[model samples]
Target: MSEFIEWGALGQVVVAGLIIGAGIPALFALGLRLLAGTTTQPQRAASGTRRAADGGVPAGPVAIARPTPARLVGAIACMGVVVGAIAFGLVFLVSGGH
Candidate 1:
């Protein structure tokens, strides 16, 4: 078995495969989580208000907070890694695995 397989090269291929396959999706998810800010819920109207006529529930638009500078940077970095990996794979394929 050892004679049939170059263990070192196979190990490297497995390691690279695992990293690219798992790391890219994980980074993308992290970027999305970082970029997704908190949503502001609609406030309830005071008593006897026009909105109160509709069971005190005011129909208002939910506002999404903008990501902080640090979060934005983090998201960019994470997504950049994912994109870079994809581009590298594409280039590798186009280059005929050269």
Candidate 2:
């Protein structure tokens, strides 16, 4: 029975499964986090804007600051990798996994 099982192939399958299953979602989440950056008070709020009420209420709408150039680039790269991986999988399936 041991002779019939290909350990090398099994190992490869396990590694691939872990990467495609866990790695892709991790990268995607990272990309989303980088893209969102953070929310903060707007620069130079207009005088008309009322201040937040006492009790932790926000004075005005908080704005999400744009991601820095480096972070933006990193996010794009991560998303690109995810998309590429998905496309590759679809193509592979269509090609009969040859």
Candidate 3:
């Protein structure tokens, strides 16, 4: 009698699904995080202007961030992987990988 379960194919499918489903999102999130970099202290106005609203809350300082070249490259790489995965998916679908 033939085996009912194709363990090898099932495993491959599960692994591929896990990698494509989880890894892609993780890479995208990593790219965003790397691009965003770390935030420094809030920036103060150059003119040294501070305004108080009618609600009595003073205006807060603006935020500033700068990403290093390495970080930028890493971010680009991660995003590239994500885009490539998407392209591969499109091609796979078009080629009837379904």
Q: Please list the C-alpha lDDT of all candidates, in the order they appear.
A: 0.87, 0.85, 0.83
Q: List the residue pairs that clash in candidate 1.
A: none
lDDT score of model 2?
A: 0.85
The sequence of per-residue lDDT tens digits that candidate 1 reaches over residues 3-54 is 9999999999999888988878989999999999989876655554446566
Count of steric clashes across candidates, in order = 0, 1, 0
RMSD of each: 3.8, 3.7, 4.1
lDDT (Cα, tens digit) per residue for candidate 3, span 37-85:
5766555556635565524433565455689999999999999999999
Residue lDDT tens for model 2, 1-98: 38999999999999998999999999999999988868876555456455556444435556877899999999999999999999999999999995
Cα-based lDDT at residue 2, candidate 1: 88
lDDT accuracy of residue 68 in candidate 2 = 98
* Model 3 misplacement above 4 A: 43-58
Model 2 residue 33 CA deviation in Å: 0.8
- Can you give the TM-score per candidate against the true fold? 0.73, 0.76, 0.75
Instruction: Kindly give the stretch of ten consecutive residues in candidate 2 with the minimal lDDT sum.
Output: 49-58
When summed lDDT is taken over every stretch of 10 residues in candidate 1, the lowest stretch is 44-53
- Output the TM-score of candidate 3: 0.75
- Runs in model 2 deviating more than 4 A are 1-5, 41-54
